[model samples]
Target: MKEKLYAIYFEPEDWLAFRESRRFNPGDTARTVFPSPFPFYGAIRTMLLKKYDVKLEYHQKPNLSQELLRKIGDESQPGIIKLYGPFVYSESEGKRKHYFPAPKNVYKCENSGYKTMHLFDTKIKLNCFKIGLAWIPEVEGIKEVTESYIELEELRKLQSGQSFVLCHAPNLIEEVKTGIALEESVKRTKEGMLYFLRIYRFKNGGFFMLTDSEETVKEISKIEGVFLGSKQRWCRVKVEQFGGNIFQRIDSKNVAMMLLTPAVYDGGIVPKEGKFDDAIVKAIAATKKTVVSGWDYTSGKPKPIYHAVSPGTVYYLDKFPKDDETVVKQSYYNEFGFGRFVYIPYENLKQCEGGEQNDEQSFLALC
Candidate 1:
């Protein structure tokens, strides 16, 4: 039987901490508005085990019966389950709307309008090698929309090369609390050991994800709430069938792939050979790399460190891949939805119909 897609919403009951991989030290801030997929993976898996009446001892011992093991795989592997997102969502008037990271190729102008970057076929010499294609902004005085998000309707308009306005993301507030460390043996406060913990509380909305795992649907369907993030913060869980598609494939020779989640590639930010399936990468617009690592409860150790390409990164391709399956097959950690992307026509962006465009002379002067 084919698996069904479901939307899982997490409405937080209190402030939540989504810390990065960096060690939390005295005077350091442990806060983030967005979190990676690792935490959600662990949380859902644990909940599933609890629903099955699996004992904690079995997690460390791996002594489950063959049938039980098949249902929920032993440590180090998640059985037949796949996860995507931790995207932002809001509910109003009994309807829920989703938001997504804005594509890097899109820029916001000083005049409150948006513009798309155009790919130019020119060879430029770098420190060691030369690059053939580069993405150039259509107008001057525009900044890349990196730290912003767009509503689901805006994303659809973007995918279809239509003019769309940016929507303000839900507000997120950070609160810091102080604490002092104490010596465990002496039961006394450690001298000069003060720290501040920063946590986030959304002003209006919470995070959500899309999953097709039958086991997850079955277990979460029976529960009204679940604990997530640091301190086991409680969050109301809402699951519903999702019928719409987020990605719309465009048939074009020049296509752009926008990352919806951080991607980990063995060959660094760009894929090996600058190729994804049958399409060759012509240009790229990406943000700084981020380190992704987490604690492995099953093994009682830290997960392997990975340098991930940030979400919202856009890769211009020579053509659309022969098949979507082949493109996904080339990505790493795809089961966790790490390299998820949407393809759109690249040439349409060059028209600059949504926003003002500079003349050829001015653009050349800026270049």
Candidate 2:
């Protein structure tokens, strides 16, 4: 019935390691910025069960948890609606600033057409131009290229002083941790187990919303902390509520779907390009490849190496095809924040907000 919003904040003790691939050898364990949403879904379900005094199981049956989670549905009831974040939170001056996923369509301009190059200069430019309107990218710092557009309609949710914490979207930094490999039979330490390097750098937080149903807010409010993500990579999160909707109204005719979290599509690594339904609307401007992993319930093992469209990818639709049913029917990939996005008027980029310079005292505090 009513709308309820909850934000999850994770404060790591020191570092967290989300193993990207299944390889577990010393110096072979790698990590990524974020993990797939299936683990998060499992984590929340575990929390709910714990709150309800349900027994925790070592091994859960296939799809059994899905049926159990169905009981927590809202009035609209199309499964559970979830939106994960790739936003970056850092302090600017005395106030805090939020950085959302900049659409992949925005790029560095060369001459007339387009060029893909990182902007590494004295200062980054906040000014941007839309497709067909620009003349020079050689002069301007950053420019939006052909068919390059970002949706801001749903972003109106952030306009009303509602702050959100991002999940699984971390700037990866590498660090070395030391450990000893043990011998099973002799019960002694082995050699060549001195140290290993891992990508320990990541921001652990997620911002999501839930429909207030069956006293959902009541149970969640009582929660002080919950362990999210990998068990070995223990992350104690502080769950709290903030004001305003994280998503805004999508009233524009031409819209783009941007990935805030990595999405899994069928078949090949590249997301297939096609229309919504024959010619209702066509899909254009899919971005490059991103790797993501998840825990499999059926086999009870780490899922195979999978590729997903990275966050900040912009998928242009011919028009915002005015059929809610069509979007819902084709939105199977959106369950885990894959094809989830907001609709903005297909327009040029506006200057971003909150890019202030902070002193050392302020900068050190966030670290």
Candidate 3:
């Protein structure tokens, strides 16, 4: 049977606490919106085990839990599932509106450096300074800093219809929670008060599709364990047949892959410079990097620093590869869905197209 794609929405009840990298502790930080798909992957796997009794020994305990160990019985196989998003959302007029990462090629520079994203919708060049204006702190109230940095207006113009919210949204309320380890307890935080970042709850989540598990989807939806980013952060989810047209159609071979969640590579192979490697560039037109790191659950230790191709970073493919099997076998991270992306068909921007027009065209594909 040909499996169908399903949409699963995860609405966080409270501020989500996700630490992508464990490099520092005292002042832990969170990726404002960028997320890794592995955590969501693990969530789905756990759902299969709990809901439909899927036998996934290989995934549970790769070493001790193998196919040979399952000779005892033929438990139900996990439904083949593929996921695409953890896209942000915003509630307007009492309804949830979906948002993807801002379109690429319209970013402004900050004092630190250039920032990139994987969940963009189109491909077109733009002068960052001309789009928006920014303020320079050192210049003492100097606001004409577009030459070096992007202003809030232009950035929002690019992200307008998209569901992404800036880290510094005025409506974004945050709270600092303090905790302390009990005396004589064997907890990681056995020393002093631990502070946590808790932002006001908002509506933003992701989508998933199960290839072989039609019946399993029903059970999975009823299981009440669907989450967006981290296990600790529980969310309310809705599962149904996907109805939107944001995803690229099957026939479109030349595609634009926008990362909804942060993708993990073997050792962070995404390029940092404007140019990409020939082989990589052959398939991908442009690429950028987003650095992230987190704790490894198994080792209970901080994960290595990861120079991931950040979520919202866009990659243009001259020609989409057709051999799915070879693509998986040859690429280390492809199968894992680390750098997974969605296809957006190409369209040339009109000469008169500006921010508003570009934003309008972004949703045209959906229409």
Considering lDDT, where higher is better, how would the candidates rank from best to worst? 1, 2, 3
Candidate 1 vs candidate 3: the lDDT winner is: 1
Lowest summed lDDT across 10 adjacent residues in model 2 is found at 117-126
Instruction: Give the alpha carbon lDDT tens digit for every residue of 194-271 in model 3.
Output: 322323445343233322246446545665655444336676666766433333334553344445445554333333
Please provide, for model 2 over 1-367, each residue's C-alpha lDDT reduced to its tens digit, 9 standing for 90 to 100. Answer: 1245555454444555443433345743233333455555555555666766666555553233555556433212324435355334332353323345555544544343333221111121222311222112234455444332222322443222222122222333445444445766886865433323233454433323333233444445455544554434444554455445444445655455555556554423223334443322223234555556644544545556556666665554445545533443454445444544544334322323477433322323534
In terms of TM-score, how similar is model 3 to the real structure? 0.51
Off by more than 4 A, model 1 = 1-4, 23-33, 57-62, 124-134, 137-147, 174-198, 212-216, 251-253, 299-301, 348-367
Residue 109 in candidate 2, Cα distance off native in Å: 5.7
Query: Residue-pair clashes per candidate, as listed?
Result: 0, 4, 14
Error of 2 at 273 (Å): 7.2
Best by lDDT: 1
- Quote the positional error of residue 130 for candidate 3 in Å: 28
Pick the winner on lDDT between candidates 1 and 2: 1
TM-score, prediction 1: 0.80
Cα lDDT, all candidates = 0.67, 0.43, 0.41
